[model samples]
Target: MTKRIVILGGGTGGTLAANRLRRALDAEYEITVVDRDDDHVYQPGLLFVPFGLAQADDLVRSRHRQLHDGIAYLGSGVDRVDTEADRVHLADGGVLDYDVLIIATGARLVPEETDGLTGPGWMTKAFSFYDLEGATALARTLEEFDGGRLVVNVVDMPIKCPVAPLEFCFLADWYFQERGIRDQVRLTYVTPLDGAFTKPVASRTLSGMLQDKGIELVTEFNTGEVDGEAGKLISFDGREVEFDLAVVVPAHGGAECIERSWGLGDALGFVPTDEHTLQSKARDNIFVIGDAAAIPTSKAGSVTHFEGEVLTRNVARFLAGEELDASFDGHTNCFIESGFGKALLIDFNYDTEPLPGHYPSAVGLPLLAESRLNHLGKLMFAWLYWHSLLPGRDLPGVSTAMPRAGKRFETR
Candidate 1:
């Protein structure tokens, strides 16, 4: 008899994990990946779409082609998971039994969760550029507007690529500058957080950049409603921020299947997992990775790549009835595009905040500051994400553990 392994997503973490496990495990293990669609999107590219730096079509590829030849791919929406029966129910009325399960279904955007967000003024005066459709629509809107108060608002926390909202503001500044209409456009960045980023040192560094760029930083503004008709963002405290064009990043939650499966996810539809082990708290045989896991880390693509490496080993260990690897240290790192052909990179983990340093090894890329090299690295990541990371090929010195080499740390 052969053991079956079923993965619930074909996104970054699931694709890498399946490919990694295919190399780690033998032919006796039947591996299958299930997803709702064949379109595998490079989500980071969506940020560049609004600025016309990247086309939405070019950033997407067939999910089936990304997977290894040996592994099976199933395209179907998930209905729910039965932990007790160890079965997965699909929206198409199919069912799959598994010896072990990997849930990597990433976060979903809930624009309608905010009052009046999807109402009359949506996609006209107000827009969201996080999705390909939204980004493409925003491009057309951006071209028509000559100048006014352009606001970028993040409705809630725990959004995928937390820095993307900031990036949009930075790029918009540059976009207007190139059109020679920047002086007429008043740019503002509004967030629920007290600073520009989650980490203190990085936040301070980024806040200064916002100041230097002449973009207003509006912190702690909890957007409760988007009065699109009135062209105002009303906060929970009843304060309002007026805008001529509104770009909002709405609240995000885990996949619907997580919520549908009882005891499988938290209130927000995110799976509860051991942060280090990536083992699902819902059951012994189920594991989690990426934005679906309720972990205190940035929901960025680099995080998924790092998590895939650690998760692949643990799943193998679990199937062999061996001790699971607990080496995942909540490590996550990403490059922040600061516009004008410059970007900044940051590396950190659960215990350490992002600090100024070179990563992977000494004399590697600089961290926590802007540079042209980092910008090149940012643009170059798309090739890496597809050809290397998704295939589970190790990138020379990059590891799941955050490196302390060449870091500038303070002594107490």
Candidate 2:
């Protein structure tokens, strides 16, 4: 008798898991992946798409090709997951029975959540760079604008790549400088957080950069409505920030299919996952990973990559009837692009905020510090993302556990 391992998504987590397990597990276990489309996007590249740094074709490939041999790839939307019966229902009325399941359905952007967000000014005066289409449209809008109040607003938290909005503002500074209109462009970063970033130190550092670049930092401004017709962003407290162009990071929610599954997700549709083990609250055999998991960490690709390793091992442990390992420490690292061919890297976990240090080894890439080398590393990551990350090849030095090497602690 063979065991069936079904994965619900073919994005970062699902694709990597399928390929990794295909290599580690024997031929006896049948592995099947279900996703809506065959397009595998390098999501980070979407950020560069608006700036003409990356083309659409360069960021996407066939999902089937990324998977390992003997792994079945099904291109169909998941209708529902029957946890009790250990079965996955497809949108096409087919059913897949599995001994183990990996739910990586990821997340969806909800621009419509904000009143007047998807209105007449959408894709005209207001745009987003979170999606490829939105990024492309924003590129055009950014190019056409000569000088005005350019405001970047994040409608809510838990967005994919929380640092990306800062990156966009940083790049916009450079973009305008190149066009000889830097002084004319007024850049503003509006976020619900009290600072530039989620962490205090990094927030201070990023806030400094915003100040240096002449980008106004508006903290704790909860966006309630986008008055696209009026060219103003209305906050919940009745404060309105007028803008000629708005780059809106809309509210994000879990996949709608999660709702159809019944009691599988939270009110926002995010799967209720165990923080340490990534196990679904709904069932013992089902595990959730990546953006779908309601974790305290940023919904970034690096988080998913780190989670995949721990999750794969846990899935194996679950199948072999072994004790679950609570080794996943919510470790997440991100390369903050600060323009001018310089970038900053940050490493931390759930208990730890991002600290300044060298990562992997005591001498390697400096964390929480801007360096041209880090910028090169950020560029190099696209290759690593496609070849190493999606294929599930563990890099030699990068580990799931966050290292304290080269870190300086304050004495009480």
RMSD per prediction, one decimal?
1.0, 1.2
Model 1 residue runs over 4 Å out of place are none
Global lDDT of each candidate: 0.92, 0.90
Distance from true location, Cα of 50 in model 2, Å: 1.5
- Residue lDDT tens for model 1, 281-340: 889899998999999888888888888877888988998899998888888888999899
Best candidate per TM-score, number?
1
- Give candidate 2 misplaced runs (Cα > 4 Å): none
Scanning candidate 1 in windows of ten residues, the lowest lDDT window is 403-412
Per-candidate TM-score against the hidden true structure = 0.99, 0.98
Worst 10 residues of 2 by lDDT: 403-412
